[model samples]
Target: MKHAVTVRNVEARPTAVVAATTTWREFPALWKPMLDEVWACLRAADIHRGCRNVMLYLDDTPRVEVGVELTQPCPLTGNVVSSSLPAGRVAMTVHYGSYAELGAAHDAVIAWCAKENLSRTGVRWEVYGPHDDDPAKVWTEICYQLS
Candidate 1:
């Protein structure tokens, strides 16, 4: 599929998250439970306010911070802590399909950066769109921070 890759500046946004280090293979199983805890923590802390599921992917070891955006800045609550999407220039694209095909979007960004001779900071993320009844309607915004 064609990916409309673009580079833009994004402002840092605070989140309520649960961070973990796991391989991509293990991520599928781990992420949801971690996010579940984040939701519970948010409910207990009373800070959760957004439906956007933002998963901040960092490093090759595959460290991830999974959570939803917060309505306002908040303090630590058990396992759920405050995190922010770093403010920087990033190569980004929106993936319109199943989450299973999301990697294609990441690959597109990598290829785009290589073609443009751009360097990445080894930080990337997927901001999931609102829920849809059909998987075909799901869209994810993938971004890679530039150095």
Candidate 2:
């Protein structure tokens, strides 16, 4: 299938995230609880009042690292700790569907990057869109930096 790709420069912003490491097969079950816990924290702090979405950063190498954080402090979690990332150029794509389809989207992005002679650096991130709470309508923007 053809994939949609966009290129843009993004700035590093302070983000609160729950970090973990897991294998590809174990990710679903592990992620749910982590997000739920983070969500609860956000709700308790009333932070989701203005938040847009959460970011899921994926790192796969010798060990896998994953982090979920809010794009905005809406209300998904409370008492979030913010951290800054470096500014860089990135390739982006929006995937519209269930989380199950995310792997394919990721592959598409990687393929596109390969075809264009671009290399990825840092952990890949999936930016959850506004409707992150809903499975069917969840919009996630997947991004990988070019190196």
Candidate 3:
């Protein structure tokens, strides 16, 4: 996959997330079930979702938070909690295709950072596009914090 990475200052965005811990191999199994709970919480609270679904990876140990952006923070209930996408300089790229193919985008960003001699914050997140059957049309913004 071809990627063009860019460095930009990002603005912090509030999100309603459900945190989960799993290995890389178990991610596919974990996200859908977590997102179901997220949706149910949103529905029960009568909250309209904001932007794309975001999965933020917190560390190499693979702690992840899966949730959608909300216009503003809501009262917390159950496992859904309010969080913010970190702001600051980031190495960013857009990945086009299946979720299974997302690793290439991450690799591309890391390589770009290395080439640019940028320091990493070890924080990464993906903003996913609308559900689609066509892999080519699916869009995901892959971002890694630069520090």
Candidate 4:
């Protein structure tokens, strides 16, 4: 399946994210608990503070490294935490489908970046949007900053 892609220049704002670094194969299993926690925190923070999307910023390292950062906290964590992502030019794309398909979306974005002669900087973030009861219906945005 193909989805429309958009490239935009975005500023990185400080956000409360539950971050975890792991290999590609281990990401899925590790992300579940962290994402669940992030959701709970967002719910507790109320609608206003709740994140509209989750971001996965891929780090530019030789080794295969991925960082999963939550836009909002899990309801259980009452603390309001925020981190600033350095502002820069980024290639943005929206993926509409099951969370499982997000990887493909990222691959597409990477390919797009290469085609445009753009290099990635720090970790690529998988930004998550509002809470969708069904994960399949959730809309996530994958953004990778240009190097």
Please, what are the lDDT tens digits per residue for candidate 1 over residues 1-147?
889999999999788789998998998899998888877876676654564789998898998999987765555567888888888899999999988888788899999999999999999988888889899899999989999
Q: Write the per-residue lDDT of candidate 2 for residues 1-147, one digit (tens) a residue.
A: 345987889887555555565676777677666566666676677655444345545456313322344455544334334544435898889888787888888888988898998888855676676665678677778888778
How does each model score on TM-score? 0.91, 0.75, 0.90, 0.67
Candidate 4's residue-wise lDDT over 1-147, tens digit each? 565556677776655555655665776576566655555666565734534445454453222222223344433353334555546777778788787787788888888888877877755666666667887677877777777
Q: State, as a TM-score between 0 and 1, how close model 4 is to the true structure.
A: 0.67
**Consecutive 10-residue window with the lowest summed lDDT within model 1:** 42-51
Q: Quote the lDDT for 4 in model 1.
A: 94
**Candidate 4 displacement at residue 76 in angstroms:** 10
True-vs-predicted CA distance for residue 136, candidate 4, Å: 7.2
Q: What is the C-alpha lDDT of each candidate?
A: 0.87, 0.64, 0.87, 0.61
lDDT tens digits, residues 1-147, model 3? 898899999999888888987898998899888877777888777775554699898987799999887765467678988887889999999998888989999999999899989999899999988878989999999999998
Poorly placed runs, candidate 3 (over 4 Å)? 47-50
Return the candidate ranking by TM-score, descending. 1, 3, 2, 4
Error of 3 at 65 (Å): 0.9
